[model samples]
Target: MVAGEPFRMLVDPLATGHCDQWLDLPETSRAGDAAALLDLLFGTDDTLDLVVLRVGTVRHGTASRRLLRGGAKGIDDAAGQTLPGHPRYELIDWRCPVCQTLVWRIHADPRRPPECPEGCGPMGMRRTG
Candidate 1:
């Protein structure tokens, strides 16, 4: 998937949260470029409270379904240890650049950051309170 293409993201919150959130790919980067996507999402953080369940282009809902199935297979392969819900794991919180929405807390370990729930694009690191 390329940048600007509609993509869905499946995410699980840090603490006792279930269900997946579908979001578009950030305008600034392409989906095939995992590094750029990760940087856009996570910023400088190395860890994240939310875990990426799956990411894929949106085309007649087939891509998302395929990704979901793959994610499920991965979970099964992990011996059911990598379930969607996990306990609280704190990370630095960031605010959305456009809407000022509080984004998910992220760890110092690099990973994909959460997009704005408002569909504003990938969130940037909040510089101030």
Candidate 2:
């Protein structure tokens, strides 16, 4: 690497650069990272066992599932306890089976998943956390 060398910017924000959208641009930053947001799970969707934890992050981007952490007593259980008295914030997770594409967001009733950029058809819900 050298000074003034071109590089990749992970997320698109109030930013102008070559965006390396290897992952989807983050929707919110102050809303908290995925783990912190897990508090939304409790009492919202009891059937949802999905959990996501952040192993690392930069630029509010990077959605690699391989880097995710927390589950069961880790992120999952803690979610129910943390943010005491906080109301539910329904979230959802969708994955593209063919390309391993992943995404998550605040969910609305009966909204369908977005089409895969890889042209793999509609992504399916893996779960929510």
Candidate 3:
């Protein structure tokens, strides 16, 4: 650690607030939507203080916010309302970084951390355009 260097805690939009658990905010939205959300919520700020003090601070990120404001009508109404391309259930394949081998495929909740069969723990994969 360096002296005078500020500490920061970074979390995706979902962690900051469970995206799917909210009304009309589908958990299966596209990655671009999530990126847009992160942009709107945490566009730019300082290390001294964060604009979002709590969960409800940044719920108005245009599209999703509009949905939230509309409120969830009912279980039936919200049923099958996920993003067009997103499947109701998505699988995530975790891999071992050291061995560069595929590991296990599981749900994308992320609350459940996946481990490498070879004890490599978890590694982040770079996204390629």
Candidate 4:
């Protein structure tokens, strides 16, 4: 590198910029259709054992196979919960699959999973640092 010398790094705007197809824009963040949302909210339509435990026992009642759609607000509320020492729970906003409505809030706890507001089932989670 020389003093006052111009250096350039080749970068593809579409691949590196905000316009990247893989980058989910704010407007296009929602799942393409309700079916996808349902899949995300609940694992699958098929019945299976789903559980969240504090130690070795179930924390909340098991969610029976059902469909829940509507009251996006309720779902949002269910998503956010307060912990003793942790920072305020942050959730990704999403559109309800059953209702196609905006959800301002939603979260999932590793120790205690969130119940489906519309009775869809239980919300899944991913570990965040």
Candidate 5:
């Protein structure tokens, strides 16, 4: 799937902390309930970076600090920890330049630039109405 497409993601609260509740969130829920859930799970936003890692048929976006700390290699490590017998997974990190929006998809291709949802041009033109 291309970036900016709406998708559902399963969150493992326990991965970030000792929580019994698991969250399944829609794309729109990312900044609202999902953000709150991440805060609760990770305890700090510093380590709450969203990384979409695919394992078999399931694609999950887990909160990880590896990306911020370890960069590309860290992403590989984070994917490895998600499931057994896998060495690495694809990473989606595309964001809209105009609005600074994180673009997400079930299977994201980073090569594809995300379109601004607010219709902001490449120059970030704002709507007057």
Candidate 6:
């Protein structure tokens, strides 16, 4: 170890809350709809964080906070819904970064990490996008 050359602290996967898990959905439905998809795919595997990563590009980036309403309804509703609606499940909303466009849909398996559809790179075992 050289003296003060440089020391980049490594972030442990567990410590950083990375390497999360989630159940992708066919569409970007309401929170409720998304949850149902999770239940179906994971079957009670709630140990992982559900991150809606960027699927494609958009003219403007919306905010997650704004998407949610009462008691985190938009986010929590997924726990009690079946499928999402049109606007809610639109690809424009689920933009894919690599493709530089919104994805038609994405349904990741809970048991496995998802791969990049555009093939720009692998969806590494990290939590955050």
Q: How much is the lDDT of residue 52 in candidate 3?
A: 20
lDDT of 6 by residue, 1-129 (tens): 232111111111222332222223332233344444433333333332333322122111121212222133333434435443323332212333454422223423222333544455534432234
TM-score of each: 0.28, 0.34, 0.25, 0.18, 0.27, 0.27
Ranking under lDDT, best-scoring first? 2, 1, 5, 6, 3, 4
lDDT of 1: 0.37
| Clashing pairs counted in every model | 11, 0, 0, 2, 0, 16
> Taking the tens digit of each residue's C-alpha lDDT, what string does model 2 give over 26-69?
33332233444434442343543333322113334332222223
Q: Which regions in candidate 6 have their CA more than 4 angstroms from the true location?
A: 1-17, 27-31, 39-43, 49-71, 74-78, 81-129
Number of clashes in model 5? 0
Measured with C-alpha atoms, the lDDT of residue 38 in candidate 2 is 38
What number of backbone clashes does candidate 6 have, counting pairs of residues 3 or more apart or in separate chains? Answer: 16
lDDT of each: 0.37, 0.39, 0.30, 0.26, 0.34, 0.31
- In candidate 6, residue 62 scores what lDDT? 20
Which 10-residue window of candidate 5 scores lowest in summed lDDT?
A: 84-93
Model 1, 65-121: lDDT tens per residue? 223333433223322232222232233556677876664342432457666666788
Question: What lDDT is reached at residue 57 by model 6?
Answer: 24
Best by lDDT: 2
Per-residue lDDT of model 5, residues 7-111, tens digit only: 222333334532211223333332223333333333333534553333222335454444323333212322323332122222233344555544332223222
Candidate 4 lDDT at 80 equals 21
TM-score for candidate 2, residues paired by index = 0.34
Better of 1 and 2 by TM-score: 2
Can you give the lDDT of residue 66 in candidate 1? 29
Whichever of 4 and 5 has more TM-score, that candidate is 5
